[model samples]
Target: MPAARPPGGVTVRRLTARDARALTTLPPAMSWIHRTWGGPEALARSGCAWAAFQGDRIVAVACTYFLGTTYEDVACVTVPDPRLQYLALDCVDALCADMAARGHTPSWTCSTSNRPGRLLAWTAGFRPEREYAHYAVGAPAATGRAAAG
Candidate 1:
């Protein structure tokens, strides 16, 4: 299904399954869990994603999910083509509006060195809280002990 455009041809409604295939082509770092777990079918089924399009092409995409109590993590991807910058911001605005309406306070996290993502999140109402370190080890085939052992 095509996105429902706004009166002034600005905002678009929530994403649908039709957008899934296109989004899958985005970089995995951007698509994150949506690419790994919920392919287009799951995106269509869950309806937790949205896109901003120009003409018939999606310029920006965002997939959001609840992390736990009181936290929702949003992953966003842009075409990275300079021509699509405005559309990317539009998607962010639309997504923030939708998240606010749903009573979910949104937060975004990226490695401190991830300059672009940090800048974008800041522009979209996210603020830097504190710096923290993260470590993870892949699970061993034989051990199920949380992958840290």
Candidate 2:
């Protein structure tokens, strides 16, 4: 299915390297492309970024990180403006369509504490899958040494 036409004059399209600069202007929270993916050039190189635009202004972004050939981890970020939040759904639709064309299943993890993220994932056709506890080990301690004890 094609992406839905946003209620306003918004449009959705695949993002390119040129879109990188605009992404920097986004609020820090909404600019994960830069923080996590090394900016738009790297994201475009990965070939899995899309954006919702109101004229020339970017309102939302969606990206997928492929896991081997079978699954894709999806993520999205949107402008803080509540009025533009709906654009995220359009981004999700577009990302799903792209994943379908590539023969991959798309999935995302939302923190149990993030009600909004969980709701959006559910609304986008994601079902509850197996839940696993997540564990992280921080960088090595000082003294230029690493110890787990």
Candidate 3:
């Protein structure tokens, strides 16, 4: 990485198990990352995760496990607070760059209905690899407001 300073005195670092707690505070839906793979155990397994911290606080996070020139299973979640959006993008940039450096062409995916997800993926340089109709059953009724469960 370059010595150039990013805005808001933000800095990026590899996320460790230590970050799991703080990451879990981001919002319930956002907590899935920590719940699933943000802890030390997952990091000890097949993949790596990274975060952007503002001083001692985690502002953004990204994790990529599956690796391939064509696709990878990636999870990206940021603090829901809008003030943190820039930091999220910064973390994403670093993640993509690092993956490219490692000889893998990283790609991302989102459900066709996830508008913001699609927007974020496109802005981050991932193109549509494929799309398919998905079916769901026994799920709660969809609501524009996030589900509380």
Candidate 4:
């Protein structure tokens, strides 16, 4: 497949199992890619992960980290550097395109508190499919913060 070239000369490409080692260097904010996929190796094994590399550094990643029975989930991450603005977005768009070509209906999720994640998901064309709610079953009244906390 053709690699995606984002601004600033970053190369975005689909990852292979052999590329697992490169994922290990993802910044802490992007660690969920490893956690959700059961490690970098398993993520690569999914055959649906991609990364944006600035030279030898993996500055961003977008992957189908969770394959669900109903819908697929994509997780994205990038170095929080302004110079890399849109780098993560480009990686996700490329990965999502790959997912679409495979006939997968991919969805994006984020901790309610993650503003950047929400923005990226929206920027990638994902709208809220559902807003989840939890029940306390008549417990004490809650504070102003809901799931967003």
Candidate 1's TM-score = 0.72
Among these predicted structures, which one has the highest lDDT?
A: 4
lDDT of 2 at 73: 82
Q: Report the number of the highest-TM-score candidate.
A: 2
lDDT of candidate 3 over 22-114, digit per residue (tens)? 565566666666555444356524336778777776677887856556655566877677655656566677778777777777777678989
Candidate 3 has a TM-score of: 0.71
Instruction: Please identify which of the two predictions, 1 or 3, would achieve the higher TM-score against the true structure.
Output: 1
Clashing pairs in 3: none
Question: Would you estimate the TM-scores of all the predictions?
Answer: 0.72, 0.81, 0.71, 0.78
Q: Residues 58-146, candidate 2: write the lDDT tens digits.
A: 88888885444888888888877877766787888789888888999999887887787787788788998877777779985566345
Q: What stretches of model 1 exceed 4 Å from their correct place? A: 1-11, 27-33, 137-149
Q: What is the C-alpha lDDT of each candidate?
A: 0.65, 0.76, 0.67, 0.79
Which of 1 and 2 is the better model by TM-score? 2
Show where candidate 3 strays beyond 4 Å: 1-5, 38-41, 44-47, 65-70, 139-149
lDDT of 1 at 139: 78
Pairs clashing within candidate 2:
none
lDDT of predicted model 2: 0.76
How would you encode candidate 4's per-residue C-alpha lDDT over 80-114 as one tens digit per residue? 78777887787788888877787788898777778
Better model by lDDT: candidate 1 vs candidate 2: 2
